[model samples]
Target: MFNIVKKMPKALWIVVLAHGVTDLSAGALLVALPFLKAKFALSYAEVSAIALMQNFTSSVSQPLFGYFSDRSPRPWLMPVGCLLSGVAMVASLLAPHYYLTLLFTAITGLGMAAFHPEAAKTANRLSGKAKGKGVSLFAVGGNGGFAIGSLLLATLLYSNVSTGVLFYILPYALLGIPLIQMTRNLPRPEVKQVGSLKTLRASINWPLLSLLGMVLSRSTVAAGISTFVPLYYVSYLHGSEMYASSLLTVYLATSALGTLFGGAMSDRFGSKRVMLYSILPISILLYLFPIVGDVGAFVVLSCASILLSATFTSSLVLAQKMMPNNVGMASGLTIGLSVGLGAMGVLALGKVADIWGMPVIFTILACLPVVGFVLTLFVEEPEEETVSLVVQVSK
Candidate 1:
């Protein structure tokens, strides 16, 4: 990993940092959810609306932004996205009404949506022959940001939400200046001017659909675990808010390391193989998490997060490879739209928590990795010819 980073271009490193800073809003949003629940006196179902609004908006808009990026690279979106996401998260803190808070969260999602496809495409292009390593490094930044952002905001919340606003603003102001400078110098892509259908016929793109299915499964597990784990610690296990939030931080931090290694593993063993091996163990661990309870639960949950997050970059690189003619759109679909859709699953699971209980949510989560595993079996690896074509087109 150190060798890979050392070899990476400075521009890619900047993109990685930008990716991390951009994701701070998402990390902050997770910590804020519990606070929003208490401040507004919200039900599980109602509190879920905040995540839904943010995730769903990003889901719907990312493909559009991606399509636009494929047609004309817009490095400006990088800084704009960081600024918008950071500003919107701060606005959520100040918004008096729950509805207003939801609106700001949605805007934050849009910022996230705007940033990913273009940044991902840039990373893919700059990755040279080591696309898996490049994409994984990029993904680690986002995962690290999620960990840091949650921890930062959670600490700030010890004082109050007002203090949390400082976290949202200062990081972006610090990071956004460099992000703007770096993105401006990104090389332009030369894509085939094929019609969208001709590029990869959606109707016949079974591999693509399989990839989406795999991503959906992964995201559902991610969304459910990330959203509910803290609540489980607090509501069921009788832990403090700080303790609950810290568990979330542990989960995300472990995931960051997993993502970093997973990418390297995918390059050697293939993305499909890495995903298949990772998901089966993840399923077993997730099933054990809620049953373990207390310290055991923390240990089980952290272990599960490592395996579960290992699949993230594998799926991303596969999607780009599959849709070689439109990597931006592929990134939008895989990272943006699929994740957004997966986050929406949180709303349904939130309803389950309301109806059945939090433990039931974990039971449902355990099944999704199996789904991802089955889809991985169906995702035919891109042909050598396809890989060669992608490299040629990218050049």
Candidate 2:
């Protein structure tokens, strides 16, 4: 462990912590959703509306940030975004009414959108020969943040409708100011970073579009799991809020662990193969969600979460490699819009949950990974020479 840490660039760990800091907002949102639902007597659609607005902003704003990242360094966005997201999350929950919650949540998401592109671009460049491992480490930081936030909020509730619980995360936001400051003086990579519109032109090809679809698919599956699982815990399983949130922590934590290894595996085998292996086999696990009891279901779902998340690092790395001149743009698209598109699925699934049930929601979600698997077949892996070229440019 010490050797691994020693071998990696300091920038990777800094971003890992930064990634963790911003994502606490997401984890807190997931845990808070059911409570907010019960307090507001929220319909499934309304619950999803909050999620939609949050994810919508989070995803939609990435390209703008990515554009800036590619065009020039904006280290300041990291702290600003993290601070905005954390404060907004606090204000969103403490607001006097529901519409205010939606507004604040959207702002909070924009903070996330602001943070990811620059952070991801930095991680990729600093990753040296271990792009997979570097990206995976960065990915896991967000995952760990979500997991820890879930656990903290679930356990720290002072009351059933506790607004004060949201304050616990504020210190993290405060620390983020200095955390992101660490990146300011770091050396910029020597790559030929492109402008925003040119990024779109560069990515305007069949393979890139198809790969983007895979990015969307991967993100949606992740979104569905995070958005709905807590609702299922509270609604279908007759579980306590703590129980429901704990399950989400388990799911996210398992996914974080999987993220730890995903990059190394991608470097060894290939991104497409890792994508194929991760996304395809999880359907059976999800298919069994209803047949088992709560414990059994958690066990199955945890494993499924690991498999579903394993592709994240590999896919992001692949997109960056493919669009070497506009890595920030690719990172933004992959991290932001793709995630936004996927999280939007929760709105549809929420509508479905209103009509059918949670079990049906999972049943429907089971097929999405297969779709992702098929899309991977159309995306050609980057050749060795291509990767080396990008590395040389960055160096």
Candidate 3:
């Protein structure tokens, strides 16, 4: 494990930092919402509109950028994206009218969409044999950035220093210098037709749809737990909202740790095995969550978060390997589509919560993993030789 960590390239580390910057900007929007609402004299529906618009743009545009990245290999998008994301998000706050703020928010999404697929592709290409580890490191950076973004910006605003919003720009400027130098000499996209759609279609492959099913299932359960569990904990279990928030923080932190380890484990034991092992237990623990005592529920939720997140990098790396010819598209679908669809799933789950109850919502979540497990069973292990062949062709 130590050796694997040591083996990652400097370029991959830069990409990881860039990934952090991207998510930091995206997450800052959440913290800015209440302030924006107050400043604009907005209603709850409008505030929700800001979030929904940002998410919709980011989620939907990623694959479009990703598909283009595979053909064009625009490495400059890395630094450019980081800059655009930070500048636009901060600008949204400073915008005078509500419409301008919303437009900046959408552009911020486009910047994030521009960042992820390219960054993920770079991480995987530079990782050498430690591709899983490399992608996981990239993922962990985003997780950390997201967690810190909310806290950092919220602290600044609460401190009554509105100028602190400008502070978010510093990291991008500092990081962008190195990123520009690093991306300058990246390999141009190869024009070979061997890794093209027709040739690759003839090769043996795992079903991409199966992997999609697995990701959707995982993301749905994850989104549900993150969104609804706090309400459940406070309302049904009688914990303080603050305490529930603290526990939710613990869950996010632990899940990031889970992402780091999951990749290393996948590298050792095959991704298919790791995916199967990581997902099945989550179903059991989630089923037990509502039935447990307070401490037990906390423990169960934490463990479930770990196990659920453990599949993130493994699935991502697997998707890249499965479609080496279209690595950017694979990354886009795995990262962007899952998030977009999962948020949609959360909306559906919200309806469930409204119609049934929180407990019923948990019951539905417990069933999702079982569906994911069945999908995993159908995902034939992606062929390493095919992965190598396509990668070589792409280069």
**What TM-scores do the predictions have?**
0.87, 0.85, 0.94
Instruction: Identify the runs in model 3 with alpha carbons over 4 angstroms from their true place.
Output: 187-206, 236-238, 390-395
Candidate 3 per-residue lDDT, tens place, 1-395, comes to: 46557867788889998898889966687789989999999999899899988888888888777778876577888888889999998899899999999999999989999999889988988887778788889999999899888887787677777587788788899998899999996664443322345433543355677888899999998888888889997887687898788778888889887887888887888788889999999989999988887688779988988888788888998888787777788888889988688878998888888888779998889999999999999887666786666667555
TM-score of 2: 0.85
TM-score between model 3 and native: 0.94
Ranking of models by TM-score:
3, 1, 2
Per-structure clash totals for the candidates: 0, 1, 0
lDDT of 1 by residue, 1-395 (tens): 58656688988998998899888888787789998899889899878788778877777899888888876677788889878988898888778998899889999999999998888988988898788899989998888787688777778777655554666578788887778888777665554433254454542377779879989989989888887888888887787998887777788678877887778887788888888898878888888886676688678878787787778888898888777767788889988889878877887898889999888888899888998889888898886587667546554
Give every collision pair in model 2.
220-342
Predicted structure 2: lDDT: 0.79
Global lDDT scores for all candidate models = 0.82, 0.79, 0.84
Cα deviation of 379, candidate 1, in Å: 0.3
Per-residue lDDT, model 3, residue 241, is 93
Which 10 consecutive residues of model 3 have the lowest summed lDDT?
191-200
Tens digit per residue, CA lDDT, model 2, 1-395: 22224588666788888899888888777677887798788998899789778878888889888887777778787778878888888777777799998999999999989889988888888888778888888998888787677666666564565555666666675676567668676786555555556545755688788888988877777888877888887888777988777777688668876776678888888888988888888777777876777789789878887777778888898888787767888899988888778877777888999998788888887888888888888998878687567545553
- On TM-score, the leading prediction is 3
